[model samples]
Target: MTSSQEQFVQKEIQKISLPSANTMRLLEINSNPEHCLQDVIDLVKLDSALTARTLRIVNSAAFCPLVPINSIDRAVSYLGEKMIVGIAVTESCGKILNQPLEGYESPAGDLWKHDLFTAFAAKEVARYAKNGMEADLAFTAGLLHDIGKPVLSKLLENASKTTIDALDHGEAKDYLAAEKLVSGVEHAEVGYQLAKYWQLPAPIAAAIRFHHNPSEAIEEFQPLVYAVHLGDIIAMMSGYSTGSDSLQYTLDSHYENFFTFSSNELTKIISDTETAFRPALESLAGKEEN
Candidate 1:
């Protein structure tokens, strides 16, 4: 990014609120392999708003529980750690994530759908991963991977065509490079800045920073990063893209080292991602509407 763009991004970052303390703690606990359901429940109980939101989602039409669930413990368990974490993030960052990106030509909610699908796809991809990766962590990482787009979208207004032209002329190898060339910034770096500002977990910050180029991530985080990378591509391939830049980025073949997916398994990942996406969308959308 140019000096001016960098300054603008930093200025804008200051205007955005950091994730809530409950949300930050929730992310940390979710990323811990040793954490149990009680940990999440305990944290949720500390924040009444989040607690109420959790219960609301559990009883929402998406779940359609035969009986209303009044207990925090049961609600957290039913929603799962991944869903709870998602709820927390939505509570904190929904406004930014749900904004329309006139720059990318994507409408409101497009980024949310894309990120949600990517989260599910990354979680599915993690099933085939080695190194004892956490699927829930991957889900969280994928959900926030494109956060920078909202920050940079206005700056990129009307620049999509130039970005595409750069790609065609080989001035840039992929959309990310073209983005930097056209606007002096790319979404990933802008996102990394936001992640750091929010004090998000290191792995998640790394995932946001290096998702488009997994190999650049440190060895410890490479597996998680690759899951998000592949998940991102799969999200776009499934047509949940954020517009103009869709499918314009390159796929890093190095992901093959971290995951092994048979053609059938890949198909199933896409199918499973779609299956999980619908109700989650309905639940969240219903929450927003209400």
Candidate 2:
């Protein structure tokens, strides 16, 4: 990206609201390896709006509890950290995440569904990491990976077809390349800028920055970044794509250094992600409809 476009991304990022303090704290606590369920419960208890949302989701049709659970402790325990974080982050960032991206030809809610699907896929992929990885952290990183799209989408509004044409004629290698060619800024770089402004955890920031090109991430973060990368492609293949950009990025074979799942396992991962995504989508996005 040029200096002028970089300046524009920074300016647009400033207008985006930071996730609420409670949501930030919840993310921090959940990202920590030492954190337990009690930490999440305590944090959720401190935010009345979050607490109410938690209760409403837990009792919603998605979970189908034997009885309505009223206690915050039971609610948090039943939903688990992954779902809780999804609920909290959605409450804070739903507007931006759910916004229509006219530039991408993605209607309202497409980005949100894609991100949520990728999150579940990443979490499952993390489980097979050669070295131990936090599934929940992967889930969190995956959920926010595409956040820069909404900011850069406007710039692409008029250039979308031109960019796609470049891809068809091989004028640009892929969507990301076309994005830079057309708008002088790609969504990943824009998202990285926003991730820094939000003061998100380093792992997440790296995942957002390098998800499309995992090999470029720092050595320490490559595994987590690779998980999100694969998850992204899996989401697109499974039909949770964000409009025209779906399946447009290259997959790095270097991921073999971190994961050794067989072809069958990969298929299972995709299936499992689809199974998990629906309930999450309903729990996190369905409440508003009712």
Candidate 3:
């Protein structure tokens, strides 16, 4: 994006410092299953709104709580270790989710809604990949994967509206291309910076950078990063206009080999995504945003 656009992203982001040191400490618990379930509740209790948001998610039907999950601790146990981290990050990325992206076709909160579906799709891919990587990290990474678009858009706020207009018409080659022509850095690079600044795990930051180019995935994070790449693509194919990436985005053949799907299965993913749409959007909306 143009230097002005880059400034816009930086200006908005600078408003919010990274989460408190305590929250960064919580981000670490994500790597360990043994600690994830217990520790997430402790982390969220520091922010009452997040605690309440997480509890509601755990009590939702996808989790099938035996009883209404009455507290963060119970909710954490019900969701188990993997889910706790996913829920926490989902809660953590609220600002990114709610923020505006001028160049994206999506309307207010629409991008965030699509991000939620992508997270769900990523979780499904991880489960089916059986890649030893935890699903929550994949989910959170997928959900916030394109967060830098907003940063870039804001950066371009006062510039001419043509770039944003092209994005609305779906004519931009990709966000990175448009962003580069308008601003110096692309969303991926900006997002990578934001993720690191937020103290997100390295794998997640890596995924953000490579979600559009899984072939570039570093050796340490390949399979999981690849899973998120496909997950976000599939999520967009299912018809949520969250990003410039779409069915048009290339899926790496090497990585596609990892997951098997028949036409029937493909149909089911679309069906599941459609079925979950309103509810998922409502879930995010109902939460008291941070």
Scored by CA lDDT, what does every candidate get?
0.91, 0.91, 0.66
TM-score of each: 0.97, 0.96, 0.78
Distance from true position, residue 20, model 3, in Å?
A: 4.8
Q: Write the per-residue lDDT of candidate 1 for residues 1-290, one digit (tens) a residue.
A: 67888899999888888888889999999778798889999999999998988888999888878899999999999989889988888888999999999889899999999999999999999999865689999999999999899988878988878888899999999989998998898899999999999988899999999999999999989999999999999999999999899999999999989999898999999999999988898887765346
Give the lowest summed-lDDT range of ten residues in model 2: 281-290
Sorting all predicted structures by lDDT, with the top scorer first, yields: 1, 2, 3
Tens digits of per-residue lDDT for model 3 on 1-290? 55665576667667655665544566567644465455676777887766766777766655456777687777766655444444555555666667656555445676676677777777667766644667776666777687776676565555435555555677666655555666667778888878866767787788888887777877778877887877777777777764433454556777755666666876776676566445555545654232
Residue 45, model 3: lDDT of 81
